[model samples]
Target chain A: MRISQLSAASGVPIPTIKYYLREGLLQPGEQTAATRAEYGEAHLRRLRLIRALLEVGRVPVTAIRQIIAAVEDETMPVHEMLGTAHYALATPVEAAADDDRHREALALVDALIGELGWQVTPEAPTRAELAQVLVRLDRLGRPASVEKLRPYAEHVARFAREREMDSVSGPREAAVESLVVGTVLYGKVLDVLRRIAHESESARRHTSGHPAAPAG
Target chain B: MRISQLSAASGVPIPTIKYYLREGLLQPGEQTAATRAEYGEAHLRRLRLIRALLEVGRVPVTAIRQIIAAVEDETMPVHEMLGTAHYALATPVEAAADDDRHREALALVDALIGELGWQVTPEAPTRAELAQVLVRLDRLGRPASVEKLRPYAEHVARFAREREMDSVSGPREAAVESLVVGTVLYGKVLDVLRRIAHESESARRHTSGHPAAPAG
Candidate 1:
């Protein structure tokens, strides 16, 4: 098959496929001409795997590249593929807001450092990232409820510690990779939990007699 | 205090403060000079709140702006603010990769669409996002015990469905907002549950025997 066919089949655009190749993420295919290349079942399978990592796993390109290399080696195992994807998705989204929000974001970062006792850097999901949540909290007129968020925070913290302990048993190389991957995946884990809590709360509210109508 | 003092005290830089004002994400301090302005505790607190939303909540600037407007209006309710933030972080990440690996992402998205019957958009989560998880999965060399993940997924679906049933009695506007927010927070809810599951897995593994070391 041709690159266009691959793109059509994979639901990825041609330009993006070119980018992946330029970035050294995807391997070079059999050259049909100076400008063209031929792909096949492996390419199709790999495309599907790549899509899974991006959609369900939320893996970044750099991480995806590494995994792709491993997958192509044939020496790599299936479990490794799944584990790598899991960790990649777990990474917290980096704060990349425009300059306008930087000050408010920095202040939030400082507050987390000074007040919340978190040892995060400005680059890690900085204040700009959390500002959205604070604004939402403010809008809801429940800025005070951050106190309520504590228990849930603690619940996550405990589990995070547990995951840390579990991660330490690996070989040094694997452990480091796992830690990096774990850090990434932790963000997604938070995402998943937050959703569940909302759903559970809504469920409880309904069972209490105030069956809320679905929003338009 | 002068902008510098505010910066010093708030740990936010002076230029960033100016940027916030320029963007209208933050209100201007007392207008002392045509160019120089004095800020106060309110500014500091508001800045902090903005930072919190950006860093901890991982909300977008546009959303933060809307949220701020709601909070300042005094018309917005507390629960609404809380709910919105929860949802913002809960929505799925966008897809942004173009490789064979993305096929996996497309498959899962298709599965969710076909088998699970969700109304999510194809652009909902990009392949780049899902690839993160795939990389980790690849590294871990474990099957994600999809069997392990299945129960949690089911639990979340049930939780969500139950909530949809319950909120039917609320005022139309509130119910509508709740559903929207519910969809957004869906990701967070899963995060929380997965963390819980990880802990449960950890506890089980720890109690079972020698810790399960990572594969070499």
Candidate 2:
């Protein structure tokens, strides 16, 4: 396929496609003439992944570049590739400005990790992100103690082990796509549904609240 | 206490705290003199929440004002207040660019809501959000059909009914705090934990293959 067809089929504009090529997000196509380069299914697949990350996940361009580098690095171990992809999804939370609250939050997070018996690295950004949330919750006087969050922790573990991992063993591109889309977007799927559930439960409590009435 | 003390207590800067007040996210303090005003504990609490939403949740100032307005409307029913809060957490997804893909995605979202037995409104923004995520996933050739997403939908429902609704029974201010923080910040918590779980799973698949080995 030519660049024009790729844009038509993928619904991405031609100039934006050129921009992606310049950004090294999409690989260059086979050179056929002075002004034209031929693309294929591979280009289309890559374009789609890039859009999903940028549009739905809202991942930063720099992080996406790193992730794409990993995807193109076919020789890289799948597990290792996933490590970088997961790490790149979140930008680092600013360190607690020497705030004592951070110390306690960090301790609380580490203890929770210990209780859960999960083998995670000490410096994983996600661990720090969790600690930051607890601190924020506490400052609001609506502190979510680890015990309060324990149930969620357990559910996440099971979801990751059973469902999220199911895709890890597929072909590299497919597997990477699963990790990128699943980690960021599906996390969203859960968030949006949780809101719906909030609505349903609120309706149950506030109104006569029959069972899940289908939307008319 | 004065605004300066509120700033100290909440760790938000004086200027930013005033911005919240001007934006109507914070209620005005009692005027003590031509140039001085006194704040109370409530001011402190509101400041913390504003910081949490802005710094951590990254909710826009406009949405924060709307949410704060809802929060301040003490006469507002809890269910109604929550409805607005959840809706405010996300801006509307662009109306599918008139792409035909949107129709199928919306149908799928409605079907999934039906299958899960969630009583959500037809016009709920979260419903539109779920549809958008699915559409993005499909474009990546990683269509997460209803079945694939069913488990998450069920998990979310259970989490909402049992855990999230627990907070709705609190005081109005506290309840609104939970809705805003829980919907936005805790959503990040889940996203982070899911990443951690991915790390552990990848470690399990790649390395020593131990259960969650504790961080050093």
Give the best candidate by DockQ.
Answer: 2
DockQ of each: 0.07, 0.46
| TM-scores, all models, native as reference | 0.40, 0.77
RMSD of each: 12.1, 4.6
lDDT of each: 0.51, 0.78
| DockQ of candidate 1, scored on C-alphas against the true complex (2 decimals) | 0.07
In terms of TM-score, the best-performing candidate is 2
Give the per-residue lDDT of model 1 (tens digit) for A1-216.
899998987777999888877888667789989988998876665555565566445678888887766655555544444344444544364454444444553454344333433323344332333444444434433341333344334444455554444653443234334433454454543345334434345444434454443322
For model 1, the superposed segments whose C-alpha errors exceed 4 Å read: A1-193, A199-209, A212-216, B31-38, B55-60, B84-150, B153-216
Per-residue lDDT over B131-185 for candidate 2, one digit per residue giving the tens place of the 0 to 100 score: 8888877866677778888888788777787777776556666666666777776
Task: Tell me each candidate's i-RMS in Å.
Answer: 11.5, 3.0
